[model samples]
Target: MYQRRTAVRRRKSRLPSYAFVLAVVSFMLAFAFPPEQPDEPSARTLPVRSLSAAACSVPPPVSQGAEPSIPSSDGEDGWMLTLVNPWNPLPEDYACTLTRLSSGHSVDERCYPDLQAMMDACRAAGLKPVICSSYRSREKQEELFQNKVNRLIAQGYSQERAKAEAAKSVALPGTSEHQLGLAVDIVDLSNQNLDSTQETTAVQQWLMAHSWEYGFILRYPNDKSDLTGIIYEPWHYRYVGKDAAAEIYRQGLCLEEYLEQTA
Candidate 1:
């Protein structure tokens, strides 16, 4: 009986150690293989949704110091947003009512008032802005292109090379935005040169910063020439109506990109 009781005591003494080992083993197993978590949406998915929303949202109209309200898409004025480039040429019969400016340049009648207002504002700020070029008939554009090509050829470039070189600065007839009457080339009165260097002047800087307020945008910004299919032209501005201009300015997009994104 005493031996049996001693055996029972020994078994009781080992019980706590066995329980402890079992608990340790369970913890090690849990550490090795954890429970599966429920799948959740990833963070990367948010931007796509946000981008979709942005793409669909209508651009807000400009406020305070903004130009006139943009017309409805059904109106003739809607042509303000038309895209003209080497790839997208103007229609053969396209035309608009022309209004002559005091500068001897002409623009679409619809845009003339805004153009005058913008120039007036510049003059108020002591900047002498000059309109260097504006509306061009198809024949005029052809002449300009041929003149540039001839000049390049006279400089000893091959015919093919001359055409290519001239096209870099002057668009081929139907592709020239000047034919649209909504585009204008402006220069400081003291320096009428149209070059990339014009971007450095205070007048040009002012136009770049404030043109959107008057329903205008820089047509070929220095960084957007590749997309515009033209060289960087700091002096060129296009009237795209207030809302579109503001949106284009806000996004820093060329007209082609703006059209593509909205389309």
Candidate 2:
């Protein structure tokens, strides 16, 4: 009987030891590690994977002139804006008002006059002036031009035709509006969804009501594609200075229309 009692006690002690071993094994397996641990804790897990070394990052969006998921925040994406005068593309030597580039996205430099005034006015109106795209270098244009050409070729266009089509969509080195340093691509300040539809923002109404006051004119319009040799672009606004903005708004003229009358 003593021997039998001794055996029961031994079995009970073994149960606790077995349970402790199982708990230790569970902890190691749960952590994907061995039983032995390093004195130091493992490095913290990082979930973000960045493609570049830039300190700042911009979200990925399709190239410009391509429709945003937002369905454009304005008419024809805001091409209905008034063109005050013929924006004789300003001289190249003009200094920019302020410049900010977007990293990991296509946005480059923010040019002066219009962007500066627009930003100030937006702030004053309690709006945020979000830059969509700014200045693109000649090299950048070439890259875009080449990409368009490639896409056209893939779509069965011959080299010459692809070149021609690309020309309409992609500006040559000196001909780009960006070269003038007065254009900016901005998003509506009130609502900030990357993919929000135009109906979701009031920028269109605000711009229509006040864009001319800031010396800005939507550079291209649905009514003037033939003259510009490009499709209507609503987000692009040119800074023609206040006088031109006034005349354009007053006469209900686009840049093309104003140019025709003056010419």
Candidate 1, 108-192: lDDT as tens digits? 8878888889999998999998888999999999999999999999999999999888888999898888988889999887778
Question: TM-score for all predictions?
Answer: 0.71, 0.52
Clash totals for all models, in order? 0, 3
Can you write out model 2's per-residue Cα lDDT over 46-164, one digit (the tens) per residue?
11111222211233344467553322212132221222111222223322333554332232232254556666776687766566655665566568778989999999999988887
- How many Å off is the CA of 120 in candidate 2? 3.4
TM-score, structure 2 vs. true: 0.52
Measured with C-alpha atoms, the lDDT of residue 156 in candidate 1 is 100
Query: What global local distance difference test value does model 1 have?
Result: 0.74
Instruction: Give the Å error, residue 18, model 1.
Output: 50
CA lDDT scores, all candidates in order: 0.74, 0.51
Candidate 1: 10-residue stretch with minimal lDDT: 1-10
lDDT score, residue 77, model 2?
21
Best by lDDT: 1
